[model samples]
Target: MEGRQLQQVLNPQRLKALQEWMQKSSITLTQVNGQRKYGGPPPGWQGPVPGPGCEVFISQIPRDVYEDRLIPLFQSVGIIYEFRLMMNFSGQNRGFAYAKYGDPVTASTAVMTLHHYRLPDGGCLTVRKSTEKRQLRLGDLPTNINQVKLLTLLRMVSDGVEDVMLKMAGPKGREVVALVNYSSHYAASMAKKVLMQAFKKHCGISITVKWTSFSKSKHVSETEQEDGTSTPPGLNPFPKPSISPPHLHPQPFLHNVPAHPPLQSSFSAVGGPAGPPRDEMKPQGPVNCDTVSLLQWMCEVHRLGTPQYEIRYHHASSDGFLCFSYEVLIPCFLIPLYGVIQILPGPSAQATKEEVYRAVAELVIQTICKVSSLRPF
Candidate 1:
């Protein structure tokens, strides 16, 4: 079947599979006169032809200039397909504009020569390929899309992905840029349609997918690099929260508990007890249970240093003379301790290890007095 006939017969699934190999590529047909005597206005040196009917973006124009200014400047050389001054939400000119010339010859000449010219109001004009290639193409896609990924997605949407390329700006890792390339205009149009409705969230930033004509130098191949490296952690989505040393019962063990009770995962389960053996000090029962292992895993995944943790048990009947000591509490117990300390009285929270310990001990001592023998652990 020819292109259009094949398109009709294939079901969506079959159409999807063929799309990869049959990716979109722009076909530039140079219009000709039948008798061969057709000529060129070919006066000065104009660069490569943009291939008939391509569009170019013209920007940095004086807002006051209207259609009267645009028609003549562009029509003087080649056919003026259309001209538009990009506007803002209020319909005011954005200072930049876009224009489509009839064919490659006109578009290229405008980009190379007219680019540096000054508009009537002395505004410098720069002509580039527009991001709105969707006007002349196909596919549905979001605007803030990752260029490389967009091509891959376009293949899934339609058989029109013309080409895929990434552009990098700035220095190496800090480069700020967007990916761009072409697709059969149809493919480009479809991508724009799909992405606007469905693309994954990236750092809470929305995806944007559009058309581009940057098939040259600024165009990047996957292998090319201007010094790229891994992005630093924490700045990205869902970084593991770091449980700093301040959160832990600094001294994992004290006179309160005898054994550090190696939890079996973290090597930081260092320095045994301060007093006597765990059993001798307090009629020790099973110090660790199956749950400790699970807790250890959570700590590792959450980056909570388990071995440096503690759990302190105290005598319930100490009156106001209650004294408590650091006994290396696991992150499970310590995290809540942080909350408890939040509403704690003033002078007690001195931001020092001694102050925190003192405050926690004081709160526990007072809160526990109201409790009976079965103290809430």
Candidate 2:
């Protein structure tokens, strides 16, 4: 089956015929010559062994699949206990992973549903119940990290992290390791991978993050709260408001564009080589080439010596709709234009370019009317 083509392995017509024959013959199609049966044990073998209820084995996973991509795929199936992508010494994926499901029944269901699942990259998955019932590993962190800080970081990475526990290593318990437990195994796996990548890329630190055996002898404690408060033993922490990082966080704006960058780089100034700004054009019900050109030209100019937000018009096209439509793109952020609209006569002998401009502007305004929050790129 490895070297042979699919057609050589099984012909459609013959396989259909064999299926009919088996139904008519009332006999189970157990084995073919030199080959074991599709499932079940061979002759003289004992009954099938039970799989570990919590774990799942996945194979033939695409090499490009990462933590962010993998979590969403399995998370919908059920809460996860662990998701470990096997890596080779060369620091590349080994094309397999073990995901532990919080619910044993859900783990089995995931195997049945996702087995042979087709990926966007054309790779098919092989999902099955794992035989090993091992403890999940802790994500390694830098030394001197406080338990409170560790808990905050893990929570920011994922909402599923349920508890945090720390352990000491080395002489005099000098070295520290934090154990993060998740409500769902999927969250634990995601936190490990995301934190590992974030630390390396943003903080310039290489850290070990993997599954460790769960132990009954270990002492575990609840995470600390925002106000330097600790949760009671065996209880979860209360929700706290999130704080945005100072950098990379942008101020609020109509289009959510980064305002610090010079507007010249993103928007075209009016009357120069760059096109005109949008705000300068007076609300003349209709417009001609001169009016539209003036409107386009007016965008770059500062209104009353004050800088107002500008919208850059690219071009206009019409498709027999009796209306000219235009698309505008802003730098740093993409905004769908929506605002005041002015209805004007359709393109006609008497209608001027200003009328067409107004129609397009109205259309733009209509499209972006509901956008309250702009997402920064």
Candidate 3:
């Protein structure tokens, strides 16, 4: 009967409902005086109590595992108050879960019995009493997102974003998602709105979000008679009439980029410096390995790293480094037959006009002349 009651609480529909409620209500994992205005701890709960055996954190949940596997494993020793596996926006496990027992003694017993127990998937569990219960995972972000860009977007939503994680995702295991941990639940709740706006503005797509926090115990007096089946105590398991933040509209991120207009060539169209038409140009000339050798020598002399040279019927491109001592990056493009190579300065590079443009036309022309004389077939 005890095991049967535990299974009822772990039902998929019930868990889904709890997750939805938690997301809609902006439930959090931390205990704070300011959270009362948002919503107090979940239904049938007293408040935060700091002591041993109240709760245990399981840090290594295998991917194949679920509530069914977890509920029975923990309930073997004692009656549990609540159990929750932290989930991301995509409804995938975030590699951790939490369980609180009816009493501190039961919690300790479970910890001792199952701390290092290995799961079927070969993952050993890390269960121990939780002390610092303040963590939340942000999910449903676009794939291949730049971290710096994501951070800038998050800051637009809240000033309390303390950490960020980009983890693997997708059915094919090829996509990436973002996870943000805020200093407080309030900041995290507010983050949801701003992140949504940021996603739409930057990615041009709507995103889903889910909130996951550690479970806490309901007040002992409020849950004395029942079999142990109840919604796990989270930030607020039961919704209450609470004041909402008046404004959740997110402002633009600090590094937000404005739309760019179509690119126009600096060289004009008719009779421009872009040179002769493709049909009018001479046939493919003899290949110039000397120029390639010279380019390689130049790269080596300056310790600019290895350079790649490409040659095609129409033109060629080669990549070469400018500096080797530090991390300064300058992009230098070589245009075939055009005689000039354009070197663009990096963002933080303090290069002067002279440093940006170096005359290598003479060498290029010489190499082309020497190579062109060899053949034209």
Candidate 4:
């Protein structure tokens, strides 16, 4: 039976017809920040927001498949609260998506019923409970980093930092460890991906980052309270730094702009007379290859003035991923480049803006490298 379904999906003519049918159907699909959402809190939904364990992570979908087929199949188990399929720029599915139900029991039913369910493209879906872990443990931090300062730094470099607690680690308490809480699991996951690199690049610090189990984190908090080492209620931990880093200064040019406007409708800036000598722009020593730094270096080497950016926050998903649309005006380019990025919710608008800036910078650099005949680097 599954083989027959696979045959039907693989038939070019039938697949085309199926796609055409879906296009004409009333199902509303919207693309936002790299994900194709069928229904965010599906239409007519009146239930309370889903809690932990209410979502199932699904994988092994065929790239050609879309929500048209997947949604109805999953609906057999329970009412879907939301469905998001990660999409590629090339108009293909990323072979994985998320299906959220209204309650944990329904979510579990999805896993039990859908796990290893065969798809029409000869793929067996891998369905499981979403971990939804929302805390991270950062180790080997500078011993001098107090909770307040560390919290500030984390907010600057990453999004969705909710709280920070510091503790001594290593022999003789020579090292500091921070247990950071993010507003959502997605935020904690994003921070885990970039915290080490961000710390090294921006703060010149090498630290360890790892996901902490809730039980482990709870134990640590309890221990701190018992030892009377926790920060007192209503008291600030550590004094604010006297001087802020130059690079950490907020970019004044960034502001909310209309999203998805035509290229000609967006702001554009032409390159001014070359600012600095070419050699000064290109680092004499080993270059920092991180996206933002690398793009800045490239702009300098090519004599383009500093890049200008505009970022706008869109709606966040029920799962806690904040979506943003961004545009970067490279002085050398004829038009600004724009795209979407999703990150965990940030503590402030500025933190979210910084994440979008890095994302758009990387996109611009890639575009330049792809189109330039001569190697710019």
Candidate 5:
């Protein structure tokens, strides 16, 4: 039976046989940093680097399943540009992998044909389009930092830093932010884990590292139109500037919200009227409030000065979600509020910032609403 054969193939004693099977099949896998990769574009023919939507995310793989089975199955759809299987120290797969093809059409075909396909062990595979994120947003940097210097410093600390773009941050443009593109998502992820500590130790400057949003509005719009679903409004209030300066772009300005806005109106929209009485009211769901508006309302009600955001760390998971460890400083409280949040990957820098802000606002509102003492009006 297929199941019995699979069990035999995966037995510890059969690893040599598996390797020999791979060799006989002309499949070469190289291990690197907890992943086993086949073909940096595949050994055979020449073509351009795979673009967006050319990769399919595969999950629900049986730990015993290796490329010897997966690669050939995928190749039945089309030529595989590359394949990577996440690995563990115990010599088994991490239950997920990515398969890239020569084009988006082929990737789509692989997803259509292989998704939910049953394995010999009765496990089904989950396959879908990959976002292919390869950029990191570095925030709270010095305004004087230049692209060349940043690229140099990043290279000293991380690998696959292909390009760096500088942007002005803060209302008066007093701070700088950098958008760093890596050769691959894996490289960017590894760099993100180390860049925060590396910068603090080497340059004595603390920085916020997060995945940069790559906009997918065009594709989303097309899909929505086909489904006859209405498009959502843009979360960011400010319009993007018409032009970017050389390698520098403008950062999201959080100070644009009026400082003296009536707090009652804001709370009314989120829950009921703002004040001590409203403290008991639970937010219906995610507060439909933007970060700037929420911060303004918080400062006005609590008498706390402008809050500070310090992203301690952030990383994108294989499932296309970004997780962040962040701190928010309230003037009235000596210690900053620490928490973690997960959000879907966004399409642009501004969109991503808005998502973080909205998430933080929801957290703040939920927290204060639960603890009346924290309101201290």
Candidate 6:
């Protein structure tokens, strides 16, 4: 059983026949070679100790709505043993989480009756039976966000974030790029949910949202695929959110923040060639010596004019992170680092820096989207 190949292991069979045979036959069917047993321990044998309770998962709820708004809604369906909103690595909501009831019957009742119940905000809530653990993101933040901002914001959300990185990128003068990394992928997903709600506080700037990890690589939509990292986010493996008891804590206010890097980088080079200088870089989770660094093969950025800049993240390293980038050459342009977006008035007239920036920010915001807020999706 340990080293046997598929050809030598359990014989592939019609699932229906196997199910019928298993139910009728007192003799257990080990496999192609009959080396294992597929039955309970013994007649009067008791099962091993039970661990955590099964989870009842819920997803797609908008974050601005709070725990108070939710508890009663669920209670209307069944007596919940416990309830909680899961936080992510960046302190955002993962748009999904879990709940638990005192018994399986109660959990089942909720699944059947309240799985798709409507929220006060008028969004469909998706619920399901689950057994996995729910990772917490900690708290909330503004929705007009990027990865870096989320990581920073979530440290305030909970105590578990050991490390995280959020990045944002896109063409200069266009929407700049941003993504947030969490010490745990679970934490990152939760942060995204909470951040979208909290960040939407600004007048008309709702941060665009998407997810990438070792698993599903594509953004939540075609729009979020600006910096495509293939079909998967690298190596993410997903375990759905499960049910559990709830835990609450008084959240913090926005006014308080750690001494931040005066994020003065200009809008012209948003999510540009070189990511923020590797200041206090946090190494990813521990790996064996064989685990290599996922750094760039080659990269360089060249500004041609106001509408364009050349960038290259060549996947030069044969077996390394297949990194690559593109160059912009539209109204040729060059934007200085740490400045506002400067849409040069003409081909090469010294851009009235302030005026140019204001114009560009307005245009990019308009083109990408006019989203004032984001509810759960």
lDDT of each: 0.35, 0.41, 0.42, 0.58, 0.60, 0.34
Off by over 4 Å in 4: 1-40, 87-94, 156-159, 170-173, 193-206, 213-377
TM-score of each: 0.28, 0.28, 0.26, 0.46, 0.52, 0.24
In the range 237-308, model 2's lDDT, one tens digit per residue, is 122222222232222433332222211111111222112344543444334544334333333231111111
Question: What lDDT tens digits, residue by residue, belong to model 5 across residues 163-254?
Answer: 67676655666667777767666677679789999999989988999865422234443322221111111112111112222223322222
lDDT of model 3, residue 367:
35
lDDT of 4: 0.58
Better of 2 and 3 by TM-score: 2
**RMSD to native, candidate 1:** 28.0
Alpha-carbon deviation at 249 in model 2, angstroms: 40
Which residue pairs does candidate 4 place in steric collision?
160-345, 160-346
Tens digits of lDDT, candidate 4, 181-297: 676555676688889999999888788887653221223333122211111111121222122122221222222222222321111111111222234335342365545777777
Candidate number achieving the greatest TM-score relative to the actual structure: 5
- Alpha carbon lDDT of residue 239, candidate 2? 26
**Model 3 segments more than 4 A misplaced:** 1-53, 132-377
For candidate 6, report its TM-score. Answer: 0.24
| Candidate 1 worst ten-residue window by lDDT | 226-235
* TM-score for candidate 5: 0.52
Write candidate 3's Cα lDDT for 100-161 as tens digits: 65444355556668878898757898775543222234556666678888777777656677
| Candidate 5, superposed: residue stretches over 4 Å from native | 1-10, 13-17, 156-159, 168-175, 204-206, 214-377
- Candidate 5 at 99: error in angstroms? 0.8
Q: What are the RMSD figures for all models against the true structure?
A: 28.0, 22.6, 25.5, 20.4, 17.4, 24.1
Off by over 4 Å in 6: 1-53, 88-92, 133-377
| Alpha-carbon shift of residue 233 in model 2 (angstroms) | 36
